[model samples]
Target: MDKPDQIPPLSIDEISILFFNRQNPVYIDVYDQQTYRYFIYPIINRTVFFGCLIITLLRPLSHLERITIEQGSSTLALELAKQHTLTEVYYQKTHEYFTELLEYRESELILTKGKELGLNMNSIMFVTLFKISSYQDLQVLEAIIHRLVSIIKQQMARTEKIVYGFHNKVTLLISLSSSDSDHISSITKLLDSIIKEWNRKDGPPLNAGIGNSYYGVENIRKSYDEAGKALSYLTEQNRPGMIRYGEIGLNRFFLNQKSEEIERFLNEIFSPLWSHKAKKNELEKTLLVYTDSNRSAIQAAEKLHIHINTLYQRLKKIEEALNLSFNNTEDMLKIELACHLKRTFNA
Candidate 1:
């Protein structure tokens, strides 16, 4: 057998058989410096051997060149397959760790894994969820997410951040240095930049929800839950903006209530307005404007683009419809509460 670097002489019949009968063979030219001759050889199954005795007896040089290029492409494809397999395995293992961290299970083991993965669990950490507006091709979305993650990781290297894509959303667990006081502001700026980049690239619109930052790996689950809750609110409200868990305040209390419960409360409070088919929304808006204007008839009318006397007339109708006098502070309080509920729940 000839070595890979050696090319032996052959007859035209042998070259014809090699080209037609061999499977996936590479053709190359070998130069003999001593004899100053160029030889054509076929590399088949890891063995090098000569082709046609006269180069012209073989197929056109163009055909041979095409085969050589195809061989190079095949080799490149094989290498890429190997790399993709390795990446899938790595992602599986990392996903397991992520699941455990989010569940708050085996804190010590997760912390150890974090250490092995070069994550700093001692820093102040928060969770953020970036939600895309609609479904897209998984591969395309993943490519976009990978690019965004690479950019964020590169920019936030000093902050110790980890990003993952799961359930059609990109989740980021970022840590801040001890001296970082404006954590929410910093993350908001980062998200704004990311969203701008995504928009520039014609990607789906993205909304981000951030959780409160806490110290230590054990508290990561709390942040994750908070982030998820914040994301749910953003989705339910159909609003595209960043919301922090801590900033929701009293709205969180109302959001936690069941839809049925909220509906029942609204029905009970606004039954009189509900009875009016043509003017329910109009009356509700009037009440809301009045309440927002601190019950000042002039200001409420001005805001609503109505006359002061018209505002008083509407207020009187509201009082008669609810069968309660606004002079009674308790009744006024109930109306104010109803207005708040309406504004918050979009009822």
Candidate 2:
């Protein structure tokens, strides 16, 4: 296969000399971060018409480019980008360089392509449903999450909020953006498309958040949260690999926190109870609600719509069965985390 370095990277020094050597240029060549990073050779030509041949052959962009031309001067640079499906391009010298090109969006597209190429997610918007059955493997899993997070670096981007709520499995996601009317319908369609594509595939245990049309890298965590809930709903429902955020709806954020691995955590927590699937599931539900209701048994009962006494009885039974007391702040914190485990790791 051809290599990037083999293709040649345009040198800034060489390009500067070439541009300055030209006569009164109608369109002087300018290589922004994207052009410089992608092309070993700078994009330069005698007129707007010259360098487009190269750009059309290589589509390396995450956004559409815009080019403004003076009337009767030349054909537009943006026209070339659009015809070739280039991420973006600009003609006017006054136009700012493609700063957003190197934006997190580029990283995300690269990550997505990596997944398509069968590489593990460096985490980010794609929530990993890893099953580290033993305690030792959990270390590797933790390392994976940490590394994945650092690779994506969502914090530095201009995006919507990323909120995490874990029952045990970490539920990171980006918030939805309904600000643009054109985007709302597109987002829904995109989510639907993901559901279709997921149902089509049949391989490695898949769990993932279907991203939204929000033009923010930060809201990736919200998308991750929705996927996690859909995974949680999987435990209740028989189907697997079917994740649609609309199914989880408003309470989605509660299931979005970051936490420990869920499947193993649940298995360890309910070892005794797992023998009886119904009772184990009952405990899981109660804990889920208990935490979801913010540690208030009364509130949990109200949400579950069971009598407060019934909730108290279940809590008491859960405490006795698990050998942990929610009354103890530390124990309660652990339980809250465990409760999240039932949701995140696709248990």
Candidate 3:
């Protein structure tokens, strides 16, 4: 046997009251459709019970009061619906503008539309891309995206930043005042903080790629392309971290080379190894280890977890297959360049 639940007493003073007047008189009752019960409001000489507590009022609503309340509620709902429609239209237009900007279509029109929307494109200093690792569920992905966007907006304290979500990536366009000299350092710190906070929240790790700062709206597309290029490097290496387009040094030049030219160079340099499928991968790994180890037989062997004799044997086999001498400075340079090209372009 259990004691009955205690019901909280009604307190009229705690609740605010709205007064309304109307001409017509009629009987009216308010019922909660979801709860399948009559709405509760305590009046003088009348007690009303709600779910767990009681709310009190001074007097019962007259028919005139009910008519006034119904009209007021309808008006408020209509106003809210209009506001929602307007918001939806604005967001649709914004998405279209951003899509065109990203696709490099109608730069002039995009800038014009951005200006109309009160977006200062000239203030944009950086484009950053965040690539999410694979996720199975769309709802989970959406949740992560919403959480990230909310956190970024709160931390940055700037509503001017533009964030757009694609398949599994988010692109952010960061804007800074013209007088801000420490833009790069500030942006880097902000991004680092965001990544750390996100990881702390038990979110999936993201690979961030940042593009160089370019002035003017016309160059925005270029910055986006550079950010994409930086992200490509991260994906190719299968590494989870941040990479800046400007920081990649000489590899930038090689990356910009025509695909056909890179393919030709790779074929010419490594065709011999490719001909022998059985040992190609093994030889390629050995060659990379040897070159990366500064051509030190002992260092390369240690890195590869192989004996010095075995490393020597592999090197001799590679020289024989390519009909080239590893000792020759020119030959070593070409091989080194080819290896770099392959790594950077995944050729």
Candidate 4:
């Protein structure tokens, strides 16, 4: 019941809301799908009430039955409201705690807040960012965030995870009991599954970028930064999938370079074929495969599923356009670098 995904199937139509004393304490009447009776409960507020209530009811209620229950529940309502106040306060505090942590406040202050929230800060942890498109409607986006947080919490029920949403992004702070590779692999696979499921839905595409794990609370900000960097790398590559900060390799250095600089380099190297929109992917793929194959025409041809003569012909066209020779060491290295940069930044 504590898991986020365990929300009861309470439909909007099945809910009857009553605001007692002008919204000071709200009473919710729910018809539980699993039980064949009705239950009326008082909640502190609407925003934090989901998954916080337990109801037992199945059938629709008669007008008289509803009134009788509402009138009789007044005494119980006050007691429940008092109990739920603490929960509302806890959520507000937790939200503030995460906001401060992500904002890179003073380390000592962060540690104090972590202790207050009962969060373990000494464990091995990393941050993973789920970058969603901003095209979704505001209400729909909020629902998506809530659903995603629930799914992630449910998936990592055995592990320690903190899921938070801000704007169009969802930040996942996962704490590991140990730095074992097996634990990392299992969690990574779970995140990959989540991304795949998200894309399978009918809305915007989803991508994940994971940062490396580190110990201590001070490195939480570092992990978050790495996650953002990895996400930028993934987006610029024009791909849909998860990318880990450690996996991006030399592209990490490229990311550190200003975007304008990267663009300048791409334009300089690819000036010859800038006008060839039709053969861009095909030609880029050809050059990359050729360079990656140790400049072996046979191997490159085999990989590209083309005849060696065809490979030679494409190389000739590339050389003519760039006015560079493959035999020149400097020119060949420049070509290799250009191909990689073009693929990485998609400039």
Better TM-score candidate (2, 3): 3
lDDT by residue (tens digit), candidate 2, 113-185: 4345333333223332211122234323343233223322343243332222121232333333345646545
Query: TM-scores of all models?
Result: 0.68, 0.31, 0.55, 0.65
Which 10-residue window of candidate 3 scores lowest in summed lDDT? 44-53
Index of the highest-lDDT prediction: 4
Worst 10 residues of 4 by lDDT: 13-22
How well is each residue in 201-314 modelled by candidate 4, as lDDT tens digits? 543677788999999776888898899999988887766779899999878988877778888987776666645566454666677898889899999999999999999999
Candidates in order have lDDT scores of 0.68, 0.44, 0.65, 0.69
The regions of model 4 sitting more than 4 angstroms off are 1-92, 99-118, 237-240, 256-264, 271-286, 304-317, 327-329
Model 4 RMSD vs true structure: 8.1
For model 3, what is the alpha-carbon lDDT of residue 145?
58
lDDT value for candidate 3?
0.65
lDDT (Cα, tens digit) per residue for candidate 3, span 46-66: 111111112222356578866
In candidate 3, stretches whose alpha carbon ends up further than 4 angstroms from where it belongs are 1-92, 100-119, 158-160, 178-182, 196-202, 248-286, 293-317, 327-330, 341-347
For model 4, how many clashes? 1
Alpha-carbon error at 162 in model 1, in Å? 1.7
Error of 2 at 101 (Å): 8.4
Q: Higher lDDT: candidate 1 or 2?
A: 1
TM-score of 4: 0.65
Model 4 / residue 97 / CA error / Å: 2.3
